[model samples]
Target: MKKFIALVSVFAAVLLVGCAPEVGSDKWCENMKNKEKGDWTANEVRDFAKHCVFK
Candidate 1:
């Protein structure tokens, strides 16, 4: 049971990490561009401008 739990935890972590591009990365910028503007959080909008646009 412990082994199975550990495997599931690891799988969840991997899936979470793989679900989004790293912040400020080119891929992240592209993803933001494609994503719905209405769905973006305030912080995401700020970071997108700070890192993706200004940089």
Candidate 2:
């Protein structure tokens, strides 16, 4: 049980790290650029358009 718990904790941490990308950072902007339009929620698309685009 203890080993299982430790494994689960590590898995959870990996998931959390993958979910959080700093908004408007270079990495986030690159992800936004490469992702299909349908992959983003409306709010996320709006934010990317506003913050990630260059004129």
What would the TM-scores of all predictions be? 0.69, 0.59
* Residue range with the least summed lDDT across 10 consecutive positions in model 2: 46-55
**Number of the top candidate by lDDT?**
1
**Model 1, runs deviating above 4 Å:** 1-14
The alpha-carbon lDDT assigned to residue 17 of candidate 1 equals: 92
- As a whole number from 0 to 100, the lDDT of residue 10 in candidate 2 is 100
- Candidate 2: stretches off by over 4 Å: 1-15
Q: Write candidate 1's Cα lDDT for 1-55 as tens digits.
A: 9999999999999999998888999999999999999999999999999999899
Report the C-alpha lDDT of model 2 over 7-49, residue by residue, as the tens digit.
9999999999988788878788888888898889988877887
